[model samples]
Target: MTTTVPRTANSADTRGWSRWAAALILPIGPAAVAVLRYVLPYDTVDDSATMVSKVVAAPGRMSLVLWLGFIAVLTLVPAAYSVGRVTRQRAPRLTMVALLLLIPGYLSLGWLTAEDQFLWSGAKAGMDAGAITRLADAMHPSAAVAGVFFVLGHVLGTILLGIALWRTRVVARWAALAVIVSQPIHFIAAVIIANHPLDLFGWGLQAVGFAAVGWAILKLPNDKWA
Candidate 1:
């Protein structure tokens, strides 16, 4: 007779952890980004919130805040990825890669945000950097490029994630619906914001993406199911 070891029915652990993580991730990432912009801006980075004019005004202070936002974006990546994985559809490898890519793209986008904030701050400081140059000529076209990349990542990865969610039976159907709705909104916002890096609404849309992911994670059955 062979004795077989069965998988533990401890999905509770993963569920608890994910729920808490979702809660923390929800606040940490976006809030940190918000703080950096307000507290760090030496020039009141309102108008040109995406330029060197701001950075030049208060190098250390503003840079710290900008970089902190950068970090917050990075921190959100894993939580989002975990939500996708919990879905258990298919192509986790690809999903994982996309998740990893999101982190840097997120940072780049924040860097772009920092630039926008910086410019606005510069304007307030009365530094007079002149008319906003063509956004194309700015630092890296990442403000535009990364936005598209983020959409692609969500589209491709989420398709697989939807499948996985269907398979794992972890997340509720409500979560699936929320996750699905989030991508298209993000895509449209990305397209609109590509040329206008200073727009905070689009950033709020991306934040919506995070909030939905957190809800989905809360809905999951946890890893013990595997």
Candidate 2:
């Protein structure tokens, strides 16, 4: 097969950097969000609100510009690079799903923060009074719905991602295989308790899928530069 047809159109490529970024993305992203979240205020959001506001605080507004901007840049550049490289590998379906979830999921900030960004129960919950007042002025009812979609996208996407990680050639393949087998089993458990107080455990299953993908990309073999 011609290099352009599949392997790589340009061995003289930046794919290495792209994969490296993907590997680091999971760990760095949350930390970055945590920092951004810190800058927003926690009061004023009511216990009865149904949406997250983009301007819950100035820091949140700025962080969205920074982190969401980062997300957009990464998606256009690294994600594009990862497309054929990761997707055409031995296991493609799951990897592709993972990527799809990750890229758009970042935008789901609206969904994830709804509980407090616009509806903080108290100052101890999220940001300060000024931020909450700002958010309330701009908050909308759709933010919660947006958040739900975001979480669902991530949750459903994990099944495919877990499969892809299990296929990475990093640790002989047996370890990957073990993870692959275990994910589906655990996934069932998560789905079973998807309601009531047990839903929290379901999240744990999802986190595994997150970690596995991170490891796969981190361990992904990039011989384009070697």
Candidate 3:
């Protein structure tokens, strides 16, 4: 007779790992991306050609950040879900609507990150300079097309979620506001500053926002939140 481990135990282990991942990544992911953007050779919105050129010429740093972003967004999902779960009992409708709005934002961000991989692939493929440049140019329009959804998903979603969390007192009010304000601040700065590095200042603020979310979630008992 063969003795078998219980499925429930294995399932429990998987869930535990997932929770730990969410706890760790929810904070670290956004924080890292915040700093990473400053170090990476990112062109301003006006210089789409330069941005494309840089990616094709040296995709290493940008690729790394994008890959990290991809993973970070995944981790954010469960963490956000936990936030909704914990707050739902207190503010059911708000939590539900917040998640619905925020999830699409995360997905749009994920798509942009995943597209960065294609840049790396093209660079590695030994394409001629003209071919690579052409490809990069071709890819440029996609960002403009997808940006509408990105704004709707992340900016609107975050604002709504932040408001929900604030109203419910699920997280610190200031922290909730930080998350809510991050995207809009970043965009406004980017627009005002235009080509300057300061355009990315919002990333730093976003780090604070995400960190607060992580702290709020982790500080609570797992059974209460998870």
Candidate 4:
């Protein structure tokens, strides 16, 4: 015989708020990032000198973009965890692997944001663009490792999570396909084609997928949230 454990009032309340928070944040973070990316004149092919020059040229706008990215990064884990939770019942192993990769991947944003901050600070101090580039190139080994982790983990994790979502039928199949394809599009746009508009479109697809997932989460009853 199996025994059922009762949930406490506090536990239920926590689940309710957590679910709502995750649902709200899931789409908002990616959508905000997508719009901010479009607002910023970002070119993937830009060298460090060019990058520093752009930042210095529009410090106020660059600062705003950086802070918005930082805020979006803060929301990543909760949003990702909620997605993982939805897949856990049908695709437990895939969910676990995705979460393992995503958690550290999202956490590594600290290193990335620090690098951006360093660039902004150097530019603010009237440092030469080349000098700022040199300093950025000399970032510590740990930071480099974090950068690698951030790139690989988020890209691969999202792909796996999308596959899990597809298999589980948790969200719309097209939405799951959007999530799976989004990162590849991002990589191609950012690295191969070096097209800012394409990059924005890729992120827009991510926002679309996340919005679908968030809607599904919101539809769940509070008792089932946990």
Candidate 5:
């Protein structure tokens, strides 16, 4: 009689490795944001003219920083989904809600990048700062709507995800709490006060929280990860 080998073991091993890869990717978004905040030249208070001037002065550096922000936003989608997946066991409803909001919120970041590109291109073309600022200031209604979605979705969704993580008790309490408060601190720093240091701290908190969760995920056995 010929012996047959089962494929189940190999399939499971593949899935387990995928989970490990995801866990490794989870903290990258927040860490990139932290680094971007540290290196970014303009604050929220800086007008388009000021921003364009900065970009003109250091086009290569500004391009790299903008690309970093773009990468951070893109990676955050998977990171958010992973958080929802891990937390679903204990807080299914909360995870569902958070993902619904967070996914779109993260996606909306692509729209916001258009303005940055416009600024960069204008500077590259040797357009006057005041002219660039004027054009940049003229926002369409759709852009405004997307901006609102990005703000509300990321802020509220992250907080809800933090709550879900807390309920699960998968990660440390401090990690969950850091996730909960990071976004509000970011809003206050970026919008209200326009403080670069505070923005750095906010992103730092997010990085710490995600890093802790990533560590916890790494420790989980393959059977438990799903």
Candidate 6:
């Protein structure tokens, strides 16, 4: 016998909002981050002063990325919640672990972006290159370690999330596969292509993954899953 669970009025309302939030945030967040990367100066992992100079050269444009990118990352909270709900039945444990990894991954990225503004201000103030170099060198160790963890969290979280969604059959399997593949592709592309506008292709793959998840969420009927 098949027993169907009934959704309450409040539950229905929450699901509706969650679906909409997922639909909007999933695509928008990655799109914003990709656009920012395309518009900003090419990124170099080791060149702090050069980065600061680029941003300080056009503080206004940098501010657009700084603020908008932060907002886009914040949207990950809702996106995570939606994912948890989607994978609750078949892969609850995996989803939980993925969320744990994702929180710190996004946080490290966000903190670094905010920290860059401080560097920008120093550059704008005509600080001596020697002083800036000393500061950058001093910060390098901790930053490098955090950067490693950031990459680990993102790659691991992506794999776990994709596997969970795929195993549960809650979303399209191809979409889950895309989400899994996008991470490593983005990293390799960033390395090989370095700082070209073509990097958008790598980032766009991430957006496609998110868009697929969002579409999957939207396709769920009101009474489908809690």
Comparing 4 and 6 on lDDT, the stronger one: 4
- Tens digits of lDDT, candidate 2, 68-159: 43543343234322432544466666666666775565556545554443343433366665665555556576776665555555445444
lDDT of 5 by residue, 11-104 (tens): 6476577677777878888777777766676776787778878877877766776887788877899999888878998899999999999999
Model 1 misplaced stretches (Cα beyond 4 Å) = 1-19, 26-74, 88-94, 97-101, 129-148, 154-163, 189-226
Residue-level lDDT for 112 in candidate 4:
77
TM-score of each: 0.52, 0.45, 0.75, 0.89, 0.91, 0.80
For residues 1-226, write the lDDT of model 3, one tens digit per residue. 9999767744554545555555566665556556555545554464545655677667677767676676667665665676666568877887788788767666666667655666667667765656755665676666655666666766676677777778878667787888778767766655555533443456566567666666666666656644
lDDT of all predictions: 0.51, 0.45, 0.64, 0.82, 0.83, 0.71
RMSD of 5: 2.0
Model 5 / residue 90 / CA error / Å: 0.6
By how many angstroms RMSD does model 6 differ from the true structure? 5.8
The digit string of per-residue lDDT tens for model 1 on 1-226 reads 9999877776324667756666467535644544453455433323443434545565666556656766776765665555555443554664566565555555455545555454555545656455433432455665667666655654555444544454554555554554445445444433443322232333343455456556655654655323
**Ranking of predictions according to lDDT:** 5, 4, 6, 3, 1, 2
Q: Specify the poorest-scoring 10-residue window by lDDT in model 4.
A: 35-44
Taking every candidate in turn, the Cα RMSD to the unseen true structure, in Å, is 8.0, 9.3, 4.4, 4.7, 2.0, 5.8
Clashes of each: 20, 6, 1, 0, 0, 0
Q: How well does candidate 5 match the true structure in TM-score terms?
A: 0.91
